[model samples]
Target: MMKKLFSLSCLPLVLVLLSGFMGLQLAEARLHYNYHPKMLFVFGDSYVDTGNTRIDQPGSWKQPYGITFPGKPAGRFSNGRVLTDYIAKYLGLKSPLPYKFRKLIPQQLKYGMNFAYGGTGVFDTSSKNPNMTIQIDFLNQLIKENVYTTSDLYNSVAHVSVAGNDYNFYLSRNGSIEGFPSFIGSVVNQTAINLVRIQKLGVRKIVVGGLQPLGCLPGNTASSSFQKCNSTFNDLVLLHNNLLNQAVTKLNRQSKDNSTFVVVDLYDSFMSVLNHPSTNNIKEPFKPCCVGVGREYNCGSVENNVNKYTVCESPTSAFFWDLLHPSQAGWHAVYNKLQTTNAFQQIRY
Candidate 1:
């Protein structure tokens, strides 16, 4: 886990002063804010994980995971594309190859690599997978090997998704709710450090995802019969996003390129879609399209060769794919929401 480096109150005063001078401004020329990014580098958990967790993540490689996209199971946690693929689409590039599979397809190296593994967080989780720090170490190793020179990263953008794995891991360990705000502070503080490290390595820009409404996740909402969200948990998510936004803003000011660090407010984007499900043609915004037959099972769970999970008739009609991830269509809807946010404009031409 990322060390609880400092409190959220430490959000530098200098960033607040520079915010007006550096952030995207309508008065600035269009060309100044737009660039043709050649590649994408990804970090964090399943939300942005394309296919990096195959070995440790058996469930994702099982049937019904990639059925929505490749017509069969792949390493993607969703039935189809998740946040990574949609971000690639928005940038007009193919989803970056998985770091685990980079050796098999060296030709695709130009596009970039995904270091994210499912079930991982900025810190180590129960999965024992590489945390965000280790993920960056992989990139550092490649750079040292001269596989990716500074030029390769100069025209590239990075996407970091913090999809609440850390918090989930915390809860699973029986961490108290009263201590969550302190932990959230550490997550955002470490995230800022990660952004700075990536920028220093030559990535032109870094887009960090904010925490979504944890109260609305299927895992949390299952108790409410999918009828409503738990406001208490969601309020904590707001705290996370607030601190994350502050960190990103400060990171932008400290970057070599002004506004190099940007944030995609997943909280607002998710809440908007959930609040108006029909606007995105979602019939069940709170429930998942894929679910376990019993609490012990999950989306792709199997026992004695018999399927232990159920899939909805139409995934597109549902907002969630499993308890923790979104369906492909769900991600597309979220991506559309990003287009309308100022933070999204930094990475999109």
Candidate 2:
């Protein structure tokens, strides 16, 4: 019989009691449950990234990034943890170590590894970071070396997050708005290919994040005084999400037995939080907790100790931590809503 994990009701108390410690022991204890995964493989961009980007990259490795979590810069692209941290928590597992740090701590390998790099996408972006294909190649190489046995993979789940960096690159490169649908198709198709490759490499289940409402990001909402989302951008985002959903459904149908692909509806979950801020306890749905002092600067901008970015009085009340990413509170709310849906169940044994 499968042992039951810690109940959700105990989370608040556990956090409070373990405030002094790193608190991973509670997560490990919770994983004693039967259906829980033994490992979690992460790929793709900043949304699920936990310090995979290089130290030379100022975007993630600088100050104000991990201010809300580890209380210092920790290479996460948010004021605290991103979606990856929440997902790991949900699975009763410690957040996976980044691929860049895998060799430094061999003991952490049992929880799996993260190949996500901030500012990366399915294809190469302006950041010149490793693309999704290369990220998977890292895993493949490790598997080839017998770092993870077939059984380890059979008991694991893979999470993929490709959060709009490709579209940003496409638009910035003067790609026509009219060709957006075709571009989305290409992205989803390549994502499907990556998913299949992971399965073939031995992963049992894969969770792919659908695009969030791009219009609702602080970068888009700034012009509207953070009061409303740009409908045109949101419409384009909807097209991407719809296509992605179809692709995931097709992948599941083509799978040998049970559904192997799951789509986390980031669109709906983001829209829900933004549309019903009161329900989610978000005081400012579109306003970012961090912003630039001028158009030339952005979150975490600091030059010679002259700070160009300002942090909000309370990051916990704001939905966006920066122009593009969600605050820790924002991700927590979205994760709560996700638990109420069937998406997460697709990965369970």
Instruction: Quote the lDDT for 137 in model 2.
Output: 95
**Off by more than 4 A, model 1:** 1-34, 55-58
**lDDT of prediction 1:** 0.86
Report lDDT (Cα) of residue 301, candidate 2: 85
State the lDDT of candidate 2 residue by residue for 274-308, as single tens digits: 88988988998999998889899888788889989
Each prediction's Cα RMSD?
A: 12.2, 11.6
Clashing pairs in 2: none
- By TM-score, how accurate is candidate 2? 0.89
- Summarize candidate 1's per-residue lDDT along 1-349 as a digit string, tens digits: 2344453444566577568666546446566556678899999988888777764455678888998898787788888888888888888899899999889999999899999988888888845579999999999999999999888898899999898888888887876686888999998898888888988888888999989898999988999898899899999999998998888777767766677888889999999999998999989899999999988888888889999999999998889999988898888888889888888877865
Residue 85's lDDT in candidate 2: 87
